[model samples]
Target: MGRHSLPDQYGAGASDPRRRARRRTVAIATVLVLAVAGGTAAAVRGGLLSFGSSCQDDPVRLTLAASPDLAPALESAAKRAREADLTSDGRCVAVTVSAREPYKVTDTLLAGKDPGAEVWVPDSEVWLQRLTATGGTADVSTVGHVASTPVGVAMEPTVAKSLGWPEKTYGWLELAGAALRDNSLRLGAADPARSATGLLALTRLSTAAAGVEGGDTQAAAMMKALSQRISDSDGQVLDTLPRDSSGTEQGNPRRNQALVVSEQAAYAYNTAADGDRSLDFFYPKDGSPRLDYPYALLEQTGLTTDQSRAAIRFMSYLDDPPQRRLLERHGFRTSDDEVPDALVAGAGGSGPQPYAEPAARPASAVALQETLGVWTITVQSARITTVVDASASMSEPVPGSGRSRMDVTKAALQRALATFTAEDEIGLWDFSTKLDGAKDYRVLVPTERLGDRKGTGTQRDRLSAAFGDLAPVPNGATGLYDTTLAAYRAATGSYAEGKFNALVILTDGRNEDPGSVSRADLVAQLERLTNPERPVPLIMIAVGPDADREEANRIAEATGGSGHEVSDPSQIQSVILKAIVEAASRDGQG
Candidate 1:
């Protein structure tokens, strides 16, 4: 789709020929008036407009979509440019600036939908990175940066004091721990998938939780704990904070202590406060993500000669000294690293101290993609039934671990359980020849809330106990086909709403049951039963060197799921996490 082409939802009314003709007539009249005033000739003599460019009688019209937070400033600049009679080759340049969410635009572009904007000024370059990584059609080129804001935590003054604020150095882990330990400290962030600040916050929080070296189980648990507090937007998150006493309320039960937001947003909130209930900024010691408002030109939109020149001229106008100062008034630091003293003080920084910049560099494309995937799993609750193979081969000793395959697998399952939040539902099942009367699979625990149970400890304890109790049935054969079909049927029948439902099968051998249905029939049945709207990804983890990877992959493909093979049983937990992330990506949830 062309850059100017609106999505189907917006219809073709805006692109109607009559509308274009009207716009052209108005533009031509405006240019003629500007030329009569001598502004066009003076600008041309000043070398502001390229001499060789087309000199159409009509002014060029360009559309610019900017992040909501930055749109107001950009619109002001665009208006000023039009009033100043900014032109390319004597033809006046007019720009229309509109507010748009970077994530939504990126999604639309990646889906092969037209964004209807010649330029995009997103809050950060992250959106551009994501677009390129996801195979967007737009050939984007960054013209320059307009403003910058770093991601930081906004806390009520009293809360900051309690946490040792400016006097103490804290990173993401410390902040996350405080929230998890104190029930009253309700930490909130925007949905990571849609907000750059939220996404950066999550990336930092997850990295901190996992530790620099990765695979920190306790940290992963903390990350999941943090996800439960996510809000829909920065504004909604700020609303949870306490307001000043001019009849304004402070934070209530749902929102209390801290929020993840951009530095500019925090400044805006503090400046609007009527009392001492202002929010203080806390830049993470480890590093924060900085949002550099990048001005990108959509080159693939097939811009007309006049439109292209108009876009260039307007971009130059926005970067002028006067326009930069205007942007500073709106709480953004200029591209030249210039921040006003008054703005700094308003955001809670004093004379000798300035708001801290991001300590860590921006994430690589691959890292950002992985972080988003992990965030999806953290937010979307899952209903999973773990089916373990307890056939005779499970008792064989693993090569390097010096432990039986079953023993290692059980240990990995126990570790994996810790990564899930309480909101997630899980169950346990075991499969072997004739395990339940003539059946190959039997339920060890019924699916229920991770935090729900009849007895003292949580459901996790019950699951761990079940895994520990699994023992290989001597002389038993693998009942892969029938057990898988039955499990899939059970999962589909009991599918929960607003949750990812799946049956995770871990096996060390191929199907060996003669009484089972044929492999082709099983694949066909699974394909026929699959539903895109109500998806239940069948994840098959082939364990040990002897496992059949090909058959496992076949089953997963038929059900819109995934398959993974692990030769080292000790790596099972990590592999399981990877599988879950991959499944989430396949379902387009991340």
Candidate 2:
């Protein structure tokens, strides 16, 4: 259940069906045995299918997909439920728990399919927001948290002693920045794009860093450093910690003296480790974000009424005294307002440390999007080709702001450009009728690394100048269809693997050029150019009232892309970031 749980083991191999059948039979047997003291052994010892069994055969069997960290505890709880003869409406209830990655499960649920589970227990509420944000047709409802764990810096005891852990306190920014400068403390974290713990911790760190004078630079520097040691998931981050007392694994560069991990993870490690361990933790003075394990029901699929009731019944059963004890033993807080002394101490905390402080505020969708965008640019750098419309409609000024759509959009783009690092590859293009003699689009910059050398300066410099120079043609008509096809073709040709590859189109109107390719032909060409092995998701931003959002969405979907609307072009960067985060997630998960 902890690290032993595999990511994609839900509904595993040929034995899955057999396992379910066995569980049904065992459920019936367990109910029958409760009627008599020795019927269980008597029936099993005799190898009896049934000894004049009068057992009413209806049973509620449910599959619960839970985060790997909580699966072991839930499995134990399920076994206890069965032993107690727990039932819903006179039918014996049984639950089969499968360990799964929350991100992958969220992707599956949003795709409007059964994720091989009737109920899902993801590690945080953020996953719910992510699932619902897509406007998914599936009806997955939250049933509240089963357990929780706070995220903080977990360090080896020696390192903690040097930092005055038990006596002195530190904020996220202070500790994280100090780690960046000090060579002794090798800091590591899970990729924020994937792990909630990482994202929450990074958000807190970012917030703290921003309050200072030179915050932007500091935050970017810290993220770049952390990326060198970032793990794909929370469990893998645990793997990066030092295993022995010496704490000197010179051969392994991945080994870390400190990490950003949840209290439950620290507790798990401390329980198994020797005296010298990474149990020493520092709960920052500012605040720590908690992973609230929400028990959500996947009611969109084959969830029967009985199965739903049985799931609810099991949820209640988890609140029982024994179940509570089980959760406590595994180092989880059932309530957010209350802090468990034993659990915190086990994860290495003391009275002076601000362990009981109120948690950090819950992150909003916008904050999450912006933070993830920062990651995509700085650490998980992307390959983006931005195509802007130069039609005459774009020349009109925005209602509230005096600036034209092109002006606000260019400023927003330049700001966005600063977020990206040298590792990122970006290109620029502008389009309208007769913009490139006969062609509808003209490439302002070729797709290449921002770090690469251009004429005098770098690619980033060339891109910045191009963005500033963008202007709308006086009498030009929209050539959106042709531009989309051309940009997508070039983007696919210059695809960079292991990066968030994308084509961004900013337009104020639909295709108005009679010579342009038909929408159907453009979509087909985009679809053909979109390689599953090397995907290039086109992000189309309809910048003003005149743009056709439906058409943008239709074309974007053909290349596994997304469409967004920006009444105020000032919000384009935020929209692009959110879209990029979604696209990157799909790329990794697929």
Which candidate leads the pack in lDDT?
Answer: 2
Backbone collision tally, model 2: 0
Give lDDT per model, in order.
0.76, 0.83
TM-score of each: 0.71, 0.83
Residues 1-590, candidate 2: write the lDDT tens digits: 11112123211211245655776798677757755775666656675545554223545899999999999999999887776556666566778999998877887878776799999999988788877666667688786678888899998777788888799989999999778886768999998877889988988887887688768657877888888999999999988876666746733666887899998999988887876664798998899888988888998877888787778777877766678789989988876577779899889878698888877788787777788878876876788999999888888999989989889999999868867777888889999998888999999898889889956999988999999999999999998888899889888888886888899999989899998889999999888888999988999999889887898999999988999888999999889988887787777668
Summed backbone clashes in each candidate are: 3, 0
**Candidate 2 local distance difference test against the native:** 0.83
TM-score of 2: 0.83
**CA shift at 74, candidate 2, in angstroms?**
2.0
lDDT of 1 by residue, 1-590 (tens): 00232233223122245754884687677667868888888766776444455333466788899998899888998787666556665566778898998977887777676789988899888889877755457678886777787787877777777878777767877877777776767788887777888878777776676655434445656657667777776667777665544425544566567888887887787777764767777777788777888878887777776676667666666656788788878888774344577776677654322354533777766556656755665578789999999999999999978999999998888767766767789999999889999999999999988878676878877887888898998998899999999999998889999987788999999999999999999999998888888888899989988898888998988988878888977767766665675577558743
Candidate 2 residue 98 C-alpha distance from true site, Å? 2.7
